[model samples]
Structures are given as structure tokens and as C-alpha cells.
Target: MVVARTRTTCVLGALLGGALLVSGCGDDSSDDAFSGQKADDIAAKAVAATDKASSVHMKGTAKVKGASTVGLDIRVDDQGNCTGTISGDGARAQLLRSKGGDVLIKGDRAFWTNSARAGGGDAKQGEQLAGKLAGKWVTAPADGPDAAFCDKKRFLASMDQDKTERQGMKRGTETEVDGEDALTLEKEQEGNRISMHVATEGEPYILKAATAGSEDSTMTFDDYGEKVKVQPPSQDEIVDPADTQA
Candidate 1:
């Protein structure tokens, strides 16, 4: 059996470290598209469209000072299944879902290193650990400890969030996300400034969203209803913490 995973630097632990990576991105290839409408109005339509589709391919990054900075690249299904990697600090973890609707997370040795750091382990231990479990998989059931934060339904719903109720939300900038034209809905509410981008051409799907100032966070949404297949880690390579912990 493997040495016990320190609750301090667990792969599942990072779930506690950051926010959602917004879903969906990209626009229709057609030339004629929605324009000249309010940012919130366009965003509302995009959210409605996404809600109607119910899934997307999402990617983004978020950083909070003195905390882990996470980068997420994942594909989410309408039913709330995510298959992707959340990488940051000294670790990388992959979240996968089975067709039977089970979601599981697996992390690399670096994940343990980071978990150790979070748990207060020193750097040398992490280095020694790297050689011990590199490329090995430490698995966690999504419903298990520290895994509730990765609920797929909650992650999907976050993309449709529109802050039209904010006191002073308005159009901010016209930018290009990977060459696709985008419109940003800008706002400042109670000292927090937010900018959300939507495609100006196709379906108005969210292109990205960001908050300015300290504790920076950004999420970009696109690829509604694309085919996503997530397979589980092989049993031979899987190690459950519960087994050894017991």
C-alpha cells in the first residue's frame, strides 16, 4: 500500500482552492449576427442559448493572492459531466465522468506535492515524493471528501450567470478572442469590477469573463453540445485513499 496521502496536499484538496472554469466558446461562421444590442441583453440571449444547449467545452484561469492559481481545460456535458485537467502550482489533476454518471478525479504526484504544501509539508518531502509517485494516479470519488466542490451541475450553471442586476453594467470593449470578435459587458459593483465577453457574431455564447484588481479571476465559455467522452483511470493504476487510510 502507498504511504497515506496527507490531507494537507491532496489532489482533491485543490477543489477547495479555486472557482469554476466557465463553459462554452466560439461563434457561428455566418456573417450576419447580433449587434447594436445592450451587453446584458446579448449576454442574456447567450445564456439562454447555453442553458438550452446544456453543455460546453470550457477553459480559463483564476488566481487569488497567496493562494493556488488554477488553470482549467475541460469538456462538460449537458448532464454535468466534466473531463479535463485542472493544473496549477505544483500539481495537475484530471476530472473524468463515466457514462453511468459517476465523476472521479485523479491527480499526479505533483498534486500530492501541492497537497503536502497545503497540508504544511516542507519542499524536500515534495521533491522526494515526485520520484516516488510520478505518473501514478491517486483517485478520489467526486462525492468523497473535498470533492463536493467539483459538482458538475454547479460548474455548468455558473456559465450562464449574467449580472444585469448590477448597479452600473454597460458595454466595455470590443476585443478578439483567438481572432473571433467579442463584446465585453463591463460593470463595477460595490468596489468589484467585472468584464464578461460574448460572441458578437454567432450564438452570443460567452467568450470569456474576467474581474479586474486583486484576486484576479477569468473564465471563457464556448463549444456548446460537442461530443465529450471521459474514461476512468485503469484499476491497475488507481489507488483510493480510503483503502489505505483505513
Candidate 2:
């Protein structure tokens, strides 16, 4: 049950507070309204900027509910390799060791060998269990600021499917995240509300996201549009001999 999660951007509450403040009036209302509107605009720009950059690099934490999620951390490479660890509860740790169909997930006690040739009850059981867990994962352009994930563009462009109305809150003014000025956008959907912070310098942009729905997940972006060094995974990181039978 290795859940294949499509990567997403960061939407920090702090950043969204400022951008969501522009849509109202009065001393506090005015401030809040302006923040919301500004955040929307900033997020859009950040997406555009991040799209334009040659690469991006980032890291963050995620908390998920409904499914088993204690803490999960992952990284993506421009060449299409997504690798990381999942630790908590009885499972301990799970590692993503490949891209797409070649993927592998190793739990602290056992591992999944994802080759098409592998077959068995444990394999099927592992896949089913992994699929039921809910948690957040981080993503950035594999190449740093100058590059972007090709699939990501399509995902963000399709925000209509999951659009939710925003909850009524006092939107804060635009603010800086880690150093970059960002605007945040907040909207409610289903039982959860999402806030996003967007910013950009040309194609190198930053977008952060936070959700308060059934699951709590937060993600951040850094050097999204700037090209940064990405190292190749060592051979050992790609496969586990213990999971493979000779």
C-alpha cells in the first residue's frame, strides 16, 4: 500500500494571513479582507515564478489523519527519483526507493520489493496497508529555481476540482517567510480550509501551503525558481539487498 502522492506546494498560515486581508472593510475587517485577496494574487505569482525558475530545493514536515501518519519526510530529484522515510507506530520506517513503477518501500521490520516479477501475500498486504495512511509530503523543482516538476504544473492548473470556500477569519497583512516577502491565500473545502503563500522573482518563486481539514499538513518552498545542485542517489539508496532474494 505504498501511496503514490503527487507532489504539492507549501501554504503557510503566516503568509496566507497577510494576503487574505484585502476583501473587507473597517479597522479589522478591512485588514483581513486585504490579506485574503493579496494572498491569492501572491500565490498565483509564486506559482508562475516557480514555474519559470530553472530548479528548486526545499524541505518541510507533514501531519496526516484518518490514515496512519506519525511523521513522514521525503525528497524529490529532477531526474524523477523520489526517496525518503516514514516512521511512527509499529511500522517504524518506510523508504521510497525508486521512481514510478520501479518504486520500493521498506518498513523497519520488512520491505516491499516493487519489481513486477515479485509476487506474494506480504507484498499485497504491504501495498494495501500503505494506501490507507494519510500524511503530507514535500516537493520542489528537482533542479532548484530554474526548473519545475512537469506534472506539478498540470496539478495546480486543476485546482477547480478541490476548491473549497474560505472560513471567515481576520486575514493578516503580507509578511516575509524565511526572508522572502509572500502573500497568503486561504479557502475552505469539504471540512477543511487551506491557506497558501505565493511569491516570485521571475520564474524563481516560492509557494507554501497549510491545511486544517481532517489532516494537518504544512509545506514550504525555497529557491523554487533558482537552479540548485542536486546530488545523485548512491547505489545503496536505490535498492535493498535484504528485500531481494538471490
Candidate 3:
């Protein structure tokens, strides 16, 4: 499933990382609420509030520069527990990571077949591997590529460090996201226009973010502070990688 894992990583990275690219400043004045605030300050508040959240549910679609579009729905907690589904290029998989660091994944036939083929297996071999692996939860190391999907702490750390400085950020009209009051912050980098909606009611968390242009991506964040519920697969339902290798 290396191909699947890599696609997931790339999509998640772009979805999460590209959303926080607000910087510089704008002088445009909107009569709407939040007109008194600077775009950079508002963006900073959203970042800080999101960073303090103990857990969150993220759902989004991202298309990296040269990759196919990927869709993900995941809930993750600071304690490292996560449960999610990822889909791309006609393949899909369900993933779970426990607080104790064990990772498990169950992929559909297309996911396994694509993985096998990506790993250099012939068409027949790919079909055979897919038959054995499809619909079965398989163990992956805590530090493996799949783990990247489950690593909330790591994701946050990367976010903290990816603060890029760019220009042309502006504040837009106030709006509601999922019924919560929000203010929009927008900026254009290179040829892509990025827009973000920061909650105005409570913690100022980013409620939605989107980029349009060279690489299209959109992500929404919600269920802040909710606990991540991750249940490990029963022994009978798990397919050990060692056995598969053997």
C-alpha cells in the first residue's frame, strides 16, 4: 500500500499546510464586521486557537500540483488516537491509530491492487495480493508511512513550522460556516488565490479554507475538543504483515 500511503500523505500535507498560508497585509476596508481587524492578526488568532484544540474532525479534498484529487474524513486527538477514511484515484482505505501507537488499515480491492502494482507486481500478482488483503485489517508499524495519517502531534508540529510569509492578505465580508459566525481572510500567492474562514463566535478557529488555481484544495475543520475514539481490530480480523510476507 505504499502508493496509497504516499498519496494520502501528499494530499493531507497539501490540505493542511496550504490552508495556513496567510501573511502580509491589506488595506481594503469592508463595512462588514471584522473591518477593524488586520488580516494577519485575524489569521494569527485562528492559528493560535486551532493549535490549542485538543482534538478536531477534518474533512477535505486536496489535489497537489501533479497528483490526483484525494478526499479524507478523519477525527484526531492530541493523544495520537485517530480514525479515518482516505480515498483517491479509485482506491480507498480505512485507517485507525490507537493512543498506544499501533496502526491498522483495511483497504478495498482497488487499493490493494494499486498498491501491489505500484510495488512492481504483475497484473496477476497484483490481483492475487488484492484478493488476500482486501477487506482485512493489516498491521503497520507506528513509524511507517501510514502512521503519518494518524500522527496529530506531528501534523501540528509541521503546521507550527510552516508559517510562510507572503503578501496581499485582505479581509472580506463576514459569513457563517456550519452555522458559526466567521470572518474571511484571503490572499493570493503566485497564481493561486487562498481564502480562509475564521470563526468569529468562539475560539476563532479556522472553520474552512480553500485555494483555487494551480493546485485546488479545500478543507474544513470542526468538532473541536471532541475525543477521538479508536478501537483496534479483533485478533481474528487482523492480518499480520509478517504472515503476508511469509
Best by TM-score: 3
lDDT tens digits by residue: candidate 3, 136-209: 99887777655766776655444445355423578887898899888877777778777888887868887887
Candidate 3: residue 18 Cα off by (Å): 10
**lDDT of candidate 2?**
0.37
Better of 2 and 3 by lDDT: 3
- What are the per-residue Cα lDDT tens digits for candidate 1 across 95-212? 7765434456566777766665666668886666555555655555555544433444554444334333422446656788767887666666446466667777767776777766
Each candidate structure's count of clashing pairs: 11, 58, 0
Alpha carbon lDDT of residue 27, candidate 1? 26
Query: Model 2: how far is 118 from its true place, Å?
Result: 14
Compared with the true structure, all predictions reach lDDT values of 0.58, 0.37, 0.69
TM-score against native, each model = 0.69, 0.49, 0.82
Instruction: Give candidate 3's TM-score.
Output: 0.82
Q: Which prediction has the highest lDDT against the true structure? A: 3
| CA RMSD of each candidate after superposition | 7.7, 10.5, 4.8
Number of clashes in model 1? Answer: 11
Error of 3 at 146 (Å): 1.1
Q: Which stretches of candidate 1 lie over 4 Å from their true place?
A: 1-11, 20-37, 116-134, 144-151, 158-167, 189-193
